[model samples]
Target: MNITWNKRQLELRERFREVATDLVAVGSDARDRDASFDRELWKELAAADFWRLQVPTGAGGLGKDGWDWLAAMEGLSLGARDLGFLMSVASHSGLIRLLLTAGTPEQQHRWLPGLTSGEVAATGSTEESGGSDIRGLSTRAVPTADGGFVLNGAKAHITNAPVADVVMLAARTDTEPGAFELSLFVTRTDVDGVGSGPGEDLLGLRTSPTGPIAFRDVRVDADAVIGGVGEGLTRLYNTLAYDRILFGIIVGSSLEAQLEPLVRQLETRHAFGAPLSAQQYMQEKVVSLTMAVEGSRALAYRSFGQLEDQHDGYSLSASVTKLFASTGLVGSGLDLVQAFGHSGYESGSAVERNLRDSVAFKIAAGTDEMQKKNIFNHVRRAYRSGELAPGSRGSGT
Candidate 1:
């Protein structure tokens, strides 16, 4: 409940903000227009050790804790003002988190160096069946006689799939099953029988490379399995929770980035007989944006603390954070566009691009419906347990 960033966190935040503004934000518009992922910029961030913020020191990382990492990422998102690029960062961070959580020592030793050094990594979970319907995935991994497995499956609409150097894949492993049993595997994209499709042209987040990845009888040793056999569901959700938490953080910072432009527009733009700032409606829009920035960051920081402490309520908090952040971001995005009028609606304009990018927040980590379902389930449990009392500020934990 401290609710304040310490000096170390503040320093890291400002440092990353400067790095992102100098290296990534400069060409964000161009990257979005061309649907390009700037590998050079990505490398620059890696060189700056952005990915190592939360990694333990023994693991060849900076050994910073979760709060510090969150602060730095907040600055990165705010300064860069490129949700697409940050989306890619979220996906990559998920991979790093998964490895940190479930990877064996050898597994970590094999992957963490390259991963921490800027090698692009992805988690292949969503398939053609859709992200929400993970239970319906058909990707199969049949075990071999030599303590290995042959993987044959495809993941679609995966962030970083088109440009990933390594992938952590989830594949069905149960030969006889009513409910699917899945296992996670680490695979290199350059291996034989592995193929990646070209990036998809999307409505928003165009700077992130997102596409399909397929494994055709791709072979991996027993060591490739993450955590254990038939244990992917838990780990998958853990990684997802991390990503969902990230969306909340990104929403907070991205909205903060919009506030300045929104206020400037209202202050300068004129209509009728006076400046738009003279209008109460325009002032309300600014207030909405400010509220969203504060609300999302508060929820995100709370969820992050729970997650870092390994609290039981972490998952629920993450869901709530993502849901609220996505809703606020999209709503505020629309208000900003409306406040700026035609110029905001113009293609390539910051507000126009931001509004478009904000739409993906609802769909990316998990749909708004998914978060609602999670929240409802949590509430139902709390209600049944007589824990849903009035004036209780708990998150139904």
Candidate 2:
């Protein structure tokens, strides 16, 4: 928990914290009331190189190891109340990785600079009605007479739909199941037939600009296909592997951030003729929840290390981290709400916001159930393959 950062990372993390706190002060109320999108804050991040923190060095980015970047990101996420902003930044970070991983040199040179400079917004598209299930996305691309292609189908839950200029999108390029069947295409958001719906009325992260859009026969040149046709899944999967681990940091640290302030309140305020902290039962409850926070922090940091090491086992590591962190969040959140009695349960308090937001953590990036399922699948692939044991389910552990 006392891990020291090098001078460069320390400076970067402190700057992010200062700026993020300022942004929260300016944007939190507006976001809570109207689900406002912080265009100005996004511009500041771009100027500060926050968007390019994970980009390759050649792409004009800081290019820290993925884990180091997560550490920096968690520092910003700690005590952060702007749900929409955290989700937005995290989503864009994933898209940046997708571009850096799959873009050709020429393509990288042409687009990455703009991304790093904040001249454009970036996003990825792959979700369908079934929640971005790899095989369930039905977006399609047809060859054009001029060596380009026509894209059709809509993407729901597309993040940053309102402002993104470059999108890493996926679609069916052929009927086969080959790696080439599903290709990744980069499209200009300003292209013809590109339009977006309003953000949703969500229980949390409402400030995020989530929406749906139809391709409606959109056009793209031949050079837009990243890593060629049918390599979309590979590219997307690689980006999300890094993305999911960061998700644990964002979710875990934010919960910790929210709970810490409330704990101080409990320490100062009396509930039954004595300060909540003085009551044995309340002390026990707060310590118990603090233990959950410490565990979440440990797992989050551990997973980030695995990611930076380029561990082949990061997928499983991420799943375990997320599973532990999120389950702890649910428990810790309940403890937080119950501790304040009706005061915490009412609207307007930070605890209420954290409570709503924590519920959403059970589902974002990857759900608790999804993490367990992926862990089980990882076990099967890594251990149970070719084993002939009867009814033996391999443990992902």
lDDT of 2 at 259: 60
Tens digit per residue, CA lDDT, model 2, 41-131: 7787678666677777887777776545665687677635775678777777776666666678788877778776765454545465666
Error of 2 at 160 (Å): 1.8
Each model's C-alpha lDDT? 0.89, 0.71
Which whole-number lDDT from 0 to 100 does residue 51 have in model 1? 87
Tens-digit lDDT track for model 1 on 1-397?
6668999999999999999899889999999999999988888899998988888888888989878888899889889989999999999988788888788878888888898887998888889878898888888899999999999989999999999999999899998858689899998999998999989999999999999999999999999999899999888888888899999889999899888888888888889979999999889998888888898888888887787778888889999999999999999989988997888899989999999989999998789999999989987988888778676546433
Candidate 1 vs. true structure, TM-score: 0.96
Error of 2 at 345 (Å): 1.8
* TM-score quality measure for candidate 2: 0.87
Which residue pairs in candidate 2 collide? Answer: 179-230, 180-230, 183-230
Colliding pairs, model 1: none
Which stretches in model 2 have alpha-carbon errors above 4 Å? Answer: 1-4, 62-68, 119-128, 145-147, 177-180, 308-310, 382-397
TM per prediction: 0.96, 0.87
